[model samples]
Target: MPSSGSYAMVLDSTFSTERRACRFSRILIDGGSSINILYRDTMEKLGIKQGQLQPSRTVFHGIVPGLSCSPIGKVKIDVMFGDKNHFHREPIWFEVVDLDSPYHALLGRPALAKFMEVPHYAYLKMKMPGPKGIITIAGDYQKSLTCAAASSQLDESLFIAEEKRLLDRVVAMASKQSDMPTDPKSAETQGSFQAAKETKKIALDQADPKRFAVVGSHLDNR
Candidate 1:
C-alpha cells in the first residue's frame, strides 16, 4: 500500500437481489475479512424485513483497532451474480451492522469460499463458476478508488461516535464527583475540577452586608 497517494485498487462489484429487480452497488470482495458484513442501510434497501433477520450476538473487530462491532442481526440473502446468459444465485448469510461506509456490502472469506471464487486484485477481476460457464466480475478502477477515498469517512464517523461516548462517560463521572458524599473519607478522588473542598460565605450586596449565601469562593461574583 502506498503511504502518500490514493493509488490502490480493489475487487469492487455489485450484487443483485433475489428478485433481480434491485442491485446493490459498491460491494467490496475482501479476502482479508473474516465475516461478511451487510450495511444496515443496504439491508433495508434490499427490502429485507426485520422479521427475517435472526438474532445474532456475534461481536467482531479489526476495522478499528480499539473498537468492536456487534451486529444487529444476521440473514441469508440470495445474491444473484453474472449475466442473463450465465448467472448463478447463492444464498449467503450476512451479519447486519450499523456502520457508515462507502460500500454497501463486504463479501468476506466466508462468502468467497462459499462461491469458490478467485479474486485477481492486479486485474481488478473476480472469477467464479456458474451454471453455464465461468462468471467474471470486472471492477472499475476509477469508481473503486472514488469509493475507497470516501471509505475513510466511515472510520472518522466511528472515531467521532467513540469520542462522544467517552465524553458522555466523563460528564457522568463529573456529576458523580459533584454529589455530596455521606462520609468525607468516601469522597471520590477529585483531580482537575479546581473546585474548593470547603465553601465560604460572601456578602452579595454591599448595602446589606448580611445578604449572602454559602457558595464556593471560586465562583464569579457576576
Candidate 2:
C-alpha cells in the first residue's frame, strides 16, 4: 500500500478556452499504463478548454476480471514533476479514462515511469546532481511552487526528453521484471526515502522563516 500522501499534481494546462491548475489525489502510480489519463470533471474544474486537446491513447482501470467498467476519454494535461531542489516540466496529451474520482486523474506507466529513473539516495533524501532550474517554475516557497520544484527543475524540453528516456527504459525494464528484486528490503528502503523527504522539508522551512504553512485554511479545519 502507498503512504497517505501519494498524489499527482499539475503545474499548468492548455485549454484554448479556459486554463487552470490541475491537481488530484490517489493517482495510481501504475507502470502498466501506456499514457497519462485525466478526468472530465477535473478538466472542467481546472478550466481546461476542450479545443486545446489533441488525440492521444490511454489505458483504463478495471481491466481486472470482476469489476465495474470504467470510462476514459482523450485529454491533455501540463505536468511538472521533480523535487524542490530539481525538477522537470512537460505538456503531454492523454486520454480521460476512468473518470470517477474526487481527485481527478491518474498517472499511469508512461507518467509514473518518468520519476522512477531519478537517482534518489534513500539515506540522504535528495536527488543526485541537484536540481535543473531551467525547467522549474519560479515562485516563493509556496506549497504549489515547492511541489513544482520538487518534481522538476522547470525545463520543459529537458523534462520531456528525460521522461521519454525513462519511459523507454521502463518498457524494457517491465519485460525484465523477473530479473529485478522484490525483496522485503524494498519496504525498508521506501520508509527511509520518505523520512528523508520530510526532513528536507523541515530544513527548507528553517532556512526560510518567512514561509510557514502551505495549506492555511485547511489546517484550521483540522
Candidate 3:
C-alpha cells in the first residue's frame, strides 16, 4: 500500500523488447490507456524491421478530445520486467505508431491485466504475483517530470519545423510561378493560399503544451 504523498509520482517500468533492453527513461506505465503502444522510432532503434509488423486498423486518441491518431501496424514481442530474481517474461502485442512521444513504449491496461499486476498510484509502485509470492517495481518521480518536459519541448520543435517546411514549399511554388506567365486569376489564388497558411498557423498554436496538460498532469499524478 502507498501513502498519500506518493500520488505525485509516476510509475515507470524497465523492460526489453525482442531486440534489446529499453532504458527506464523510455518506458511508461500508463493505466489510463487501453492498448499498449510502441513508437515507430523506438522500433527502428531496436532494429525491428517494418516487415515484421502485422497490419492493424486501430485508431487512438490523445487525452484531448478530437485528437485522433492512426497506428502504423502491430507487432508481438517478448517483454521482460522485474529484477533478475523475480523477473517475469511475456509476449505482448504493441500497436506501432509513428509519433514523437517522450516514452519509447507505454505499458497499458492489457499488459497489466496479462501480468495480473496491481498498481498502487499513491506508492508509485506495481506488484504482481510471482513464483516466490510477490514482485515489486518502483517509479522514478524526477525522471517522469524530466521526460514530460522533454517530450513537450520536442513536440513544439517538430511543429515549428513542419510549419517552416510548409512555408518553404509555398514560397518555392510562388517563385516557380514568377518565372512563368501568371494566369489572370493568380492574385486571387495567392490570396487563398495566404489564408490557408494563416489557418495552419492557428492550428499549430492550438497544439501547444497547454492543450496537452491534461495528459501530462495525469502521468505526473500517477
- The best candidate in terms of lDDT: 1
Error of 3 at 172 (Å): 13
Candidate 3 per-residue C-alpha lDDT over 104-204 given as tens digits, one digit per residue, 9 for 90 to 100: 78889999898887887766778887777788877766666687787668767766877799999999999997886467577666553443232211122
Top of the candidates by TM-score: 1
The lDDT values for all models are: 0.76, 0.45, 0.72
Q: What is the lDDT of candidate 3?
A: 0.72
Candidate 3 — number of clashing residue pairs? 0
> Which run of 10 residues does model 3 get worst, by summed lDDT?
195-204
Put down candidate 1 lDDT per residue, 180-213, tens digits, no spaces.
Answer: 6757455544433454677888787889988987
The residue ranges of model 3 lying beyond 4 angstroms of the native Cα positions read: 1-24, 63-66, 155-222
Q: lDDT tens string, model 2, 89-120?
A: 45556575433343345555565455442211
Clashing pairs in 3: none
TM-score each candidate.
Answer: 0.72, 0.38, 0.64
The model with the greater lDDT, 1 or 2, is 1
Model 2, poorest ten-residue lDDT window?
119-128
Full candidate order by lDDT, most accurate first: 1, 3, 2
